[model samples]
Target: MGFESVSDFLAMGGHGLYVWLSYAIALVVVVLNLIAPLRTKKQIHKEQARRLRREQSQI
Candidate 1:
Protein backbone atom coordinates (compact mmCIF):
# COMPACT_ATOMS: atom_id res chain seq x y z
CA MET A 1 0.00 0.00 0.00
CA GLY A 2 1.14 3.50 -0.86
CA PHE A 3 0.75 6.41 1.49
CA GLU A 4 0.01 9.84 0.13
CA SER A 5 2.23 11.47 2.77
CA VAL A 6 4.27 10.94 5.93
CA SER A 7 1.27 11.61 8.13
CA ASP A 8 -0.79 8.96 6.39
CA PHE A 9 2.03 6.46 6.65
CA LEU A 10 2.30 7.04 10.38
CA ALA A 11 -1.46 6.91 10.88
CA MET A 12 -1.26 3.37 9.51
CA GLY A 13 -4.90 3.22 8.58
CA GLY A 14 -5.84 4.23 12.14
CA HIS A 15 -4.14 1.15 13.58
CA GLY A 16 -0.95 3.02 14.35
CA LEU A 17 -1.47 3.14 18.12
CA TYR A 18 -1.74 -0.63 18.46
CA VAL A 19 1.03 -1.36 15.99
CA TRP A 20 3.44 1.14 17.53
CA LEU A 21 2.69 0.00 21.06
CA SER A 22 3.36 -3.63 20.15
CA TYR A 23 6.64 -2.67 18.56
CA ALA A 24 7.62 -0.66 21.62
CA ILE A 25 6.89 -3.60 23.94
CA ALA A 26 8.83 -6.02 21.74
CA LEU A 27 11.79 -3.64 21.69
CA VAL A 28 11.75 -3.39 25.47
CA VAL A 29 11.72 -7.18 25.84
CA VAL A 30 14.66 -7.52 23.47
CA VAL A 31 16.62 -4.87 25.38
CA LEU A 32 15.92 -6.56 28.72
CA ASN A 33 16.95 -9.98 27.37
CA LEU A 34 20.32 -8.54 26.39
CA ILE A 35 20.84 -6.61 29.64
CA ALA A 36 19.80 -9.30 32.16
CA PRO A 37 22.61 -11.71 31.36
CA LEU A 38 25.31 -9.02 31.40
CA ARG A 39 24.04 -7.73 34.73
CA THR A 40 24.05 -11.24 36.24
CA LYS A 41 27.60 -11.84 35.04
CA LYS A 42 28.74 -8.55 36.57
CA GLN A 43 27.14 -9.41 39.89
CA ILE A 44 28.79 -12.83 39.89
CA HIS A 45 32.20 -11.34 39.18
CA LYS A 46 31.78 -8.77 41.96
CA GLU A 47 30.88 -11.50 44.48
CA GLN A 48 33.86 -13.62 43.40
CA ALA A 49 36.19 -10.66 43.88
CA ARG A 50 34.80 -10.05 47.34
CA ARG A 51 35.36 -13.70 48.25
CA LEU A 52 38.96 -13.57 46.96
CA ARG A 53 39.61 -10.48 49.08
CA ARG A 54 38.26 -12.19 52.15
CA GLU A 55 40.42 -15.24 51.54
CA GLN A 56 43.55 -13.14 51.03
CA SER A 57 42.92 -11.23 54.26
CA GLN A 58 42.67 -14.50 56.16
CA ILE A 59 46.04 -15.70 54.85
Candidate 2:
Protein backbone atom coordinates (compact mmCIF):
# COMPACT_ATOMS: atom_id res chain seq x y z
CA MET A 1 0.00 0.00 0.00
CA GLY A 2 2.84 2.36 0.70
CA PHE A 3 4.56 1.59 -2.58
CA GLU A 4 3.24 2.77 -5.90
CA SER A 5 4.42 -0.23 -7.90
CA VAL A 6 6.30 -3.52 -7.79
CA SER A 7 9.59 -1.75 -8.52
CA ASP A 8 8.99 0.68 -5.72
CA PHE A 9 8.19 -2.10 -3.35
CA LEU A 10 11.36 -3.87 -4.33
CA ALA A 11 13.36 -0.72 -3.85
CA MET A 12 12.17 -0.59 -0.26
CA GLY A 13 13.15 3.05 0.09
CA GLY A 14 16.75 2.35 -0.98
CA HIS A 15 17.25 -0.36 1.65
CA GLY A 16 16.25 -3.17 -0.61
CA LEU A 17 19.73 -4.61 -1.07
CA TYR A 18 20.35 -4.99 2.62
CA VAL A 19 16.89 -6.28 3.34
CA TRP A 20 16.96 -8.78 0.47
CA LEU A 21 20.46 -9.93 1.28
CA SER A 22 19.46 -10.59 4.85
CA TYR A 23 16.44 -12.53 3.64
CA ALA A 24 18.60 -14.59 1.32
CA ILE A 25 21.08 -15.32 4.08
CA ALA A 26 18.28 -16.34 6.39
CA LEU A 27 16.87 -18.64 3.73
CA VAL A 28 20.23 -20.25 3.15
CA VAL A 29 20.69 -20.78 6.88
CA VAL A 30 17.27 -22.36 7.21
CA VAL A 31 17.85 -24.65 4.25
CA LEU A 32 21.23 -25.67 5.60
CA ASN A 33 19.74 -26.32 9.00
CA LEU A 34 17.25 -28.66 7.40
CA ILE A 35 19.75 -30.37 5.11
CA ALA A 36 22.46 -30.83 7.72
CA PRO A 37 20.41 -33.08 9.95
CA LEU A 38 19.31 -35.24 7.05
CA ARG A 39 22.88 -35.54 5.83
CA THR A 40 24.12 -36.44 9.30
CA LYS A 41 21.41 -39.02 9.66
CA LYS A 42 22.36 -40.55 6.35
CA GLN A 43 26.00 -40.60 7.34
CA ILE A 44 25.20 -42.24 10.66
CA HIS A 45 23.06 -44.87 8.96
CA LYS A 46 25.84 -45.68 6.53
CA GLU A 47 28.35 -46.00 9.34
CA GLN A 48 26.07 -48.25 11.34
CA ALA A 49 25.40 -50.44 8.31
CA ARG A 50 29.11 -50.72 7.66
CA ARG A 51 29.76 -51.65 11.24
CA LEU A 52 27.01 -54.24 11.17
CA ARG A 53 28.43 -55.78 8.02
CA ARG A 54 31.88 -55.94 9.57
CA GLU A 55 30.57 -57.67 12.69
CA GLN A 56 28.57 -60.15 10.64
CA SER A 57 31.61 -60.95 8.54
CA GLN A 58 33.60 -61.70 11.68
CA ILE A 59 31.14 -64.45 12.65
Candidate 3:
Protein backbone atom coordinates (compact mmCIF):
# COMPACT_ATOMS: atom_id res chain seq x y z
CA MET A 1 0.00 0.00 0.00
CA GLY A 2 2.77 2.35 0.81
CA PHE A 3 4.68 1.39 -2.31
CA GLU A 4 3.67 1.75 -5.93
CA SER A 5 5.14 -1.55 -7.11
CA VAL A 6 7.45 -4.43 -6.23
CA SER A 7 10.49 -2.60 -7.50
CA ASP A 8 9.55 0.54 -5.66
CA PHE A 9 9.00 -1.40 -2.47
CA LEU A 10 12.31 -3.13 -2.77
CA ALA A 11 14.15 0.02 -3.72
CA MET A 12 12.60 2.23 -1.05
CA GLY A 13 14.04 5.23 -2.87
CA GLY A 14 17.56 3.78 -2.57
CA HIS A 15 17.43 3.32 1.23
CA GLY A 16 16.07 -0.21 1.06
CA LEU A 17 19.42 -1.89 1.47
CA TYR A 18 20.16 -0.16 4.75
CA VAL A 19 16.66 -0.63 6.06
CA TRP A 20 16.49 -4.29 5.12
CA LEU A 21 19.93 -5.04 6.43
CA SER A 22 19.12 -3.51 9.79
CA TYR A 23 15.94 -5.54 9.99
CA ALA A 24 17.85 -8.71 9.12
CA ILE A 25 20.50 -8.05 11.71
CA ALA A 26 17.90 -7.28 14.36
CA LEU A 27 16.01 -10.48 13.58
CA VAL A 28 19.16 -12.57 13.80
CA VAL A 29 20.17 -11.06 17.12
CA VAL A 30 16.70 -11.53 18.54
CA VAL A 31 16.56 -15.15 17.42
CA LEU A 32 20.01 -15.97 18.71
CA ASN A 33 19.35 -14.28 22.05
CA LEU A 34 16.19 -16.32 22.45
CA ILE A 35 17.73 -19.65 21.46
CA ALA A 36 21.11 -19.39 23.18
CA PRO A 37 19.68 -19.49 26.70
CA LEU A 38 17.60 -22.60 25.97
CA ARG A 39 20.60 -24.32 24.41
CA THR A 40 22.74 -23.48 27.42
CA LYS A 41 20.08 -24.77 29.79
CA LYS A 42 19.78 -28.00 27.87
CA GLN A 43 23.54 -28.50 27.88
CA ILE A 44 23.71 -27.85 31.61
CA HIS A 45 20.91 -30.29 32.33
CA LYS A 46 22.52 -32.94 30.18
CA GLU A 47 25.90 -32.51 31.86
CA GLN A 48 24.36 -32.71 35.32
CA ALA A 49 22.36 -35.80 34.41
CA ARG A 50 25.45 -37.51 33.07
CA ARG A 51 27.39 -36.66 36.20
CA LEU A 52 24.61 -38.05 38.36
CA ARG A 53 24.49 -41.25 36.38
CA ARG A 54 28.25 -41.66 36.64
CA GLU A 55 28.13 -41.13 40.39
CA GLN A 56 25.30 -43.60 40.78
CA SER A 57 27.17 -46.21 38.80
CA GLN A 58 30.22 -45.71 40.97
CA ILE A 59 28.24 -46.26 44.17
What local distance difference test score does each model get?
A: 0.96, 0.96, 0.96
TM-score of each: 0.92, 0.96, 0.87
Residues 3-58 of candidate 2: C-alpha lDDT, one tens digit per residue: 99999899899999998999999999999999999999999999999999999999
> In model 2, where is the ten-residue run with the lowest total lDDT?
1-10
Error of 3 at 50 (Å): 0.8
RMSD of each: 0.8, 0.8, 1.5
Output the TM-score of candidate 2: 0.96
Q: Write the per-residue lDDT of candidate 3 for residues 3-37, one digit (tens) a residue.
A: 88999998888999998999999999999999999
* Collision pairs in model 2: none
Give the Cα RMSD of candidate 2.
0.8
Clash counts for the predictions, in order: 0, 0, 0
> What lDDT, from 0 to 1, does candidate 1 have?
0.96
lDDT of 1 by residue, 1-59 (tens): 99999998888999989888999999999999999999999999999999999999999
- Over 4 Å off in model 1, which ranges? none
Worst 10 residues of 3 by lDDT: 1-10
Order of all candidates by TM-score, from best down to worst? 2, 1, 3
